[model samples]
Target: MSTCGGEGPEEREREWEDAAEAVAYDSSTWPPPVVAVCGPGNSGKSAFSRLLLNTLLGRYKKVAYLDTDVGQPEFTPPGFVSLHVLEEQTKDLTMLYLRPPKRCFFFGDVGAHKNPKLLLSYIFGLYDYFLQELYCFNETDDPKKSAIPLVINTSGWVKGIGLHVLSEILRYVSPSIVIRLRTTSEGKNLPDGAFWLDVREGDSRVNIIEIRASQNSPRHLLVKKEARMIRDLRLVAYFRQCLPRDFSVFSYDDLVQGFAAIEPFQLPLSKIQVIDLHCQISDDAQHDFLAGTIVGLGSSKCVSLSTECPFPWCIGLGFIKAVNIPGNFILLITPASRRLLANVDIIFRSCIVAPTCLLQLQVSDEVDDITDRLRDL
Candidate 1:
């Protein structure tokens, strides 16, 4: 929410306007430009992406946002790769997290290091959906009503396998404008040039722009939020809404305490099916593995748990407070709407876990270590 230069709101508008002009100067010719914002951590990618989105709103009715940064998603909670079609203009991108995503995939893990291929597949699948279902190529239907432009916000790990993932994304999405933010530190910059073009040939030329990190932006990558704190805040913000609206008079401690006192929603284990995408565990151990963990609730068309179910359409996520194999029941805590939760038939043991801060009894730093080990399974 912080902007560099401490400039007035009007001054900031001018800055984004300049960038937008460069990208969409000829609206008729370059109607909807697909832009991907990428860089190392704390390089102001999120802020810049918002600025670009705001600028584009002046020209386009809607802008499609493909959030690939599961560790610190701009719109949703951590551990999801989601695609949201932005219809309303947002003042601050961070302030737009209240709504659920139009579509999302639960990757379970915070980062793609463990399963880059699956992450890539999710991104590609979302993009394909956008192109096939959302995009409007015909000029007759009304250019003003055409499919929204896409802006991709990537994770900051732009080195090693991270860089490779970004490269592969560029090759796959083929955004018309690629905005790469570079911090003062040269080492943090992504390799110079259009790296995605190293071995691949594209039908169109890709425009690459490198920008410096904002001067007044918070030092989130290094100091302000250490990854755990960011994730904790995201989870807290999400679950805090589950409380009754009249029950708003409380401090964070009071909220956490109140959350713990509430009886969890119980689901019969017989009617629900559990699937783990990353590892294979025996049926006997499935309940044990799911207990005291965060899992995604979804509805799948498949009938049998004997074979792999198609990728589920996640309706919501919940923390498993207790699992009783003997009783064939699971106690869960989640803030999702009751209507959506009613249709839940499948549960995914994903990489996502409630932060230790949100847990009733946990040390401040225990979740990072504990979640790492759990995700590795």
Candidate 2:
């Protein structure tokens, strides 16, 4: 592989143009403008979102970015709807690194269609926190006081129930600017008018901006490589922080070696309750079910087994590296802060699963042997 140099002049020019568009629509009102980027898959929604965030940083002290796309998240790992505050510009959005979000809720599933109602509740809760706590106006009399601008990035799924979920999110957010991207295919675009207007009749308060994708737009090729592969790489990149920042772990083989050699933290099963977010299974099966599974570490005071209770706040993601059923302990590997671990009261087993390729181990043997199973733990 060849090492690339700095950004070319053409790339700089296009970024400037995209930033100018965002600057033009910035509301002159007292509060910072709220912007939402929506479009179908590979339509440059993430591209446009990064551009807008860069522009907003020039105007506001900090920009609040709410990522609703769990499959291909911008700032954090997959299976989370998170809010992040950006104080500096992001030169490259493609590079996956570890950064703690200001607030996050684990959806577990990649697509919202699995549980739309629960997804909406998480989005609303984040918005409420932004409004009640992070709002810049009315809370302070200092000159530096100002509401932080918001930028929302939606998922690529834009048809059927996915479209409805987007509409519900728009209704709840009521953003000041809606940047909708369209591709060459007309059928893939959203409805002609505002899809969320039905929620509030005769309310066209939201500003709509239509953007057409260029030939050079970034696209994810799911056929050549499965989307799950990218997700696994992301998880590896995040957990690789278990190693020193100076040491590099680039490939799947390196990750497997690193994970296998590292010592895992043992959590007492009696102190924390384990609940499957998607379904209820027999107690006998929970042990094997949780082994090698990605789980959400929750810190809320109320950890209910029933689904009626709202999903608790997820502090971070953890993988059950090993389950010692008879010993009444589980070994977990996570990047969560040590302070957050003290408050963790329950572990929610999410639908998110790490790919097998990242878990496969390489065994050194001089003699020929036949084995179908690869040892992961």
Candidate 3:
């Protein structure tokens, strides 16, 4: 695990290394360790989680990651709580490279403050999915065989409702180990020792390890401007997949131009249902509101207009390039495979808006040619 910039790399290494060793090699523990990393904003929680994940990869063939930080998720884009099974070590943890998760739910907002309960429900659902499908019991006596360990990376918002949400998560998950990163500013740090546990609980058994947050890396301590830029870059990177694998983009402008010219999928309005998670839109306004916005592409056996409908299994994201009311179809740009798109019957609109640059691009006249060549499904 490399440090961005920090005074005590050796001490940080020792702290996480010891935790990793316990999780990977400790046979006394029956089930594998469920480690939850929590802290306030810019407290190196993500970095530590990545380091711990890489360390565990040395011992286990696969490690499960429950990413609850929708604002800046580890494996998926913003506004998603996902569960990912990582089989190989991440070469560069610093890079925000998007990877498909085994299971995920789109919360439709960057922050959990909008709908904390909904967010937690999604997190719990993903965790349950992991426990049922990916978590190994390790009944075999062979030393080589072991249960897959889980690393939970929590959101940076650790105050007020965020704190309550964290406590609820701790209560539900009851992880074997809780690693709390200590920020330099006392005001920003989480409560000391088992903070999530109530004082009335009488000495919680959950092991708590506290380490100083890395100070050297400016990126780790993201300001509002940098954070916004990173999110935008991530969105652009995700949409860039729509281009040909052999296509060469010389710069961001070139990439924007590529997206502007690319042919978008045309889906009949009757074939898909739209649900806005944040606000209500009138039937007449649905098409206009969805145009030029990022939407969660999902598939469900049954669809409901109610916001409380059982969360749909989101396949991926799509950008609504246009709303062809005359044609009774929508022009969408997404990188999801054709097979996955075939089953998409629900479109979830959240606050996850497309980057202004991509949305502002004027569709080239070539788009009509491309659209004409590609048949509407």
Against the reference, the lDDT scores of all candidates come to: 0.73, 0.72, 0.79
Better of 1 and 3 by TM-score: 3
User: What's model 1's lDDT at 45?
Assistant: 81
| Model 1 TM-score (2 dp) | 0.82
> What is the full ranking by TM-score, best candidate first?
3, 2, 1
List runs of model 2 lying over 4 Å from the truth.
1-20, 23-29, 141-145, 214-226, 250-252, 301-309, 361-377
lDDT of 3 by residue, 189-258 (tens): 7887776676899877677767777653445454777777778888888888999888899976888788
| Cα lDDT tens digits for candidate 2, 259-342 | 766556667776777777666577668777777788889977634333433867788888776665555666777878777787
- Candidate 3, 234: how far from true, in Å? 1.2
Report the CA-based lDDT of candidate 1 relative to the real structure: 0.73
TM-score on alpha carbons, each prediction: 0.82, 0.84, 0.87
Q: Candidate 1: how many backbone clashes? A: 2
Clashing pairs in 2: 136-146, 136-147
In terms of TM-score, which candidate is strongest? 3
